[model samples]
Target: MDKELKQLDNTFRKLPQYPTKVIQFGEGNFLRAFIDWQIQQMNKQGLFQGGVAVVQPIDRGMTKVLDEQDDLYTTLLEGKLNGQKVQDHEIIESINETIRPYEDYQSYLDLAKNDDIQFIFSNTTEAGIAFDENDNLTDQPQNSYPGKLTALLYERFKLGKKGFQIIPCELINHNGNTLKEIVLKYAQLWDLGQDFVDWINQENDFYATLVDRIVPGYPKERAADLEKEWNYHDRLIVKAEPFLIFVIEGDKKLEKLLPLKEAGLNVVVTDDMQPYRNRKVSLLNGPHTTMSPIARLAGIDTVGQVMKDPDFYKFINDEMYQEIIPTVALPEQELNDYAEGVKERFENPYVNHELSSIALNSISKFQARLLPTFKRYFAKEKKLPLRITLALASYLKIYAGKADFAPEDTPEVLAEFKELRQKDNYVQATLADEKLWGEDLTQFPGLIDLVKQDLQIIDQQGSRKAVQMINEKED
Candidate 1:
């Protein structure tokens, strides 16, 4: 049977009444299930009359599926919340329409001139913001999402329209602010004039947001059960955890703009989202970055498996609680609670987060996620952290692209590592790369020798032995 063409379940077919006031820049599952789902709730409660006009950020996305279903899709929220097993299902109907920017560039540009549009939401990922100097104002849809946004903002300014409140849900820190900065840089590069720049600076409300959700998106693995349960096949069915948090650093007026709190959501409007950001980065991202290479090399495939491994779990707790948490500036009890929550998130049995997937751009990740702890600890104790330094060494070795002691995984650190590996000076080549390490790692007392020694250990005895060696090493 062609189940996707069948009618949706009775509970999900009914559409909610709301006005289209938001132009979302990404139509992926995360935005659909998380953002749109919340909007659906708001519409149902009569707290919000706004709907989302989803814009396909890139050339390719779920626009076809969305268009096929009249911008309607089902989301399955399943997980433990507050010591209770919760499973809920709903079809999101807050998406008024979906547009492909490449095909209907004029239509997308025309959206900016709409006085009804007041909020812009996006989750274009970490690399979405960049200074693409070649992106002229006339391009159909600029190569980067931020570039397209710059053009849109300029159009809005030209029309003498009020600035829209922007809330970017990218995983990067200061995401909205960074995106605004890049857009301004593009405006300057194109010489869009001071008026437009001033409009962006003074009028536009760029609120940095911290979003938390374990949206796995599309349950391809559990298709049979899902199809049976829903009584229809949905290619775009998104699965997510029950927990969701959206912290926006903006004016309290946003409470009136987005009444998500009234609709029973964990949305927070604050003057600063720094504490929440720090908690997420230090507790969640920090452990993930440190554990990925170590776990992957330990023969564990998923984060669930790594959490199950006693050694890896202990390493995370010891490094995060005993070592990393102490260095962070937040209160001790709050940091401990965050660390506990992070451990639970890592141990999420439903998600099969691949360690190898997390290993991409690991060098840069270490600097962003883990280096703060490294710096803080060194300054406080005047000694290097052994486990973290070992993790760094493991990362460098993993980038050597080896699986069974010989080169196997594709190296994605940079071209220099590959070039240096060819010259039989892997350690020297890596340590000397000022761009990779920021400064020479050799300058950090015995860091180079320690890293080199750990690399050799990993090469000889494998990841498990290397971790054991570090665990046993006296500080």
Candidate 2:
């Protein structure tokens, strides 16, 4: 007989329910594995005495299975840290219940009446904080996440409930601030009145946050075997890396309330999170953005594969230390350690990270993650960075509608690239495109020509040949 995992089961039956002090906006695997996992630790240590009440922000979500299992799930933490294999498991009981506002609008609003709920967390995705002008206050459930939040806050204001500390975990820059802006915009658009607006501005606190963790959700292929061994069938078993960091920018109140740091959790409650944010974005994300399209064009499929190849591996290292790191202003040793961590993450055997998966929306990602470094390097060095330029060239070629590798970009971006491919002086024209890179890249004198030269080599000899040529040049 197969044993099904249940909260009411003997093994998990004794777990106590803490009051719901956190209302999380998304119940995705990331929150379960990263944030809630940390919460479970804090709970076990008796440092935090609260549970998360998850709200499904979208019309469809995983609440059904969550509710079916009585909100019980396992998180398998696996990865390498400092040359040691770290593996562990935890049954996360930090989630008390899930509310899907699309189904139960009244219950969702009624949550605002709960005096104990003091924290609001959300991970609605990159586009979740957008301002939707059409979403009205009267809708049973407002269309956008920000709109829905506005309604909830208004309800809380009307009920004279205490304001909550809002921390949004979206990947966008200044996520909490952005969400607050949109919520306030909705308030004005719907004319929720000046007093409600004052309540929002004065009573509530919105903080910028940064979250890092690689959660490869639902180990479906290996789950049956794991289930057989553990003697419990777990449908929502999430697989994630051991490395987790949550940085929040707030005042002393946050520092005092969040005692996760006291429990040795990787939570940073700081007044200035910009340095930490810069360290992560430049060291970790920059190399990732540069390598993906270039590796894919050179016929490498996964990040692990890219890290294994002698040529590709060297290119990534060279790009990080030579091109990218020079542009960052953080302490050298700190940057080096971060770079090493990036290498470890890339080489993690447990993660089957496809380069193509990272290649999605490559244009936007490169602009955000790599372009600043490229610009900074050029301005400081007074010369072009070869490896990054080559990578940029690879980006253009992959999108030129001629390469064997298919890049995933918006239709408009793809069409623009197709048009650029057909034009005379295509390299010069494309490099000068301000709409794409947010600046005229051609302003850097020799940068355009170097990219043009690389693109020429890639076109004639293929991407692999181009990579070999660059390797030879470096040598």
The weakest ten consecutive residues by lDDT in model 2 span: 1-10
Tens-place lDDT digits, model 2, residues 323-407: 8888889888889988988898988888766666567677767776778788898889888878778888988888776678677
In model 2, the clashing pairs are: none
The list of candidate 2 runs beyond 4 A from truth reads 1-14, 82-84, 354-364, 383-462
Instruction: Put down candidate 1 lDDT per residue, 286-335, tens digits, no spaces.
Output: 88878888877777877778789877777777888766888888899988
Using TM-score as the measure, the top candidate is: 1
- Runs with alpha carbons beyond 4 Å of true place in candidate 1: 1-12, 356-364, 403-443
How many residue pairs in model 1 have overlapping backbones?
1
Estimated TM-score for each candidate: 0.88, 0.84
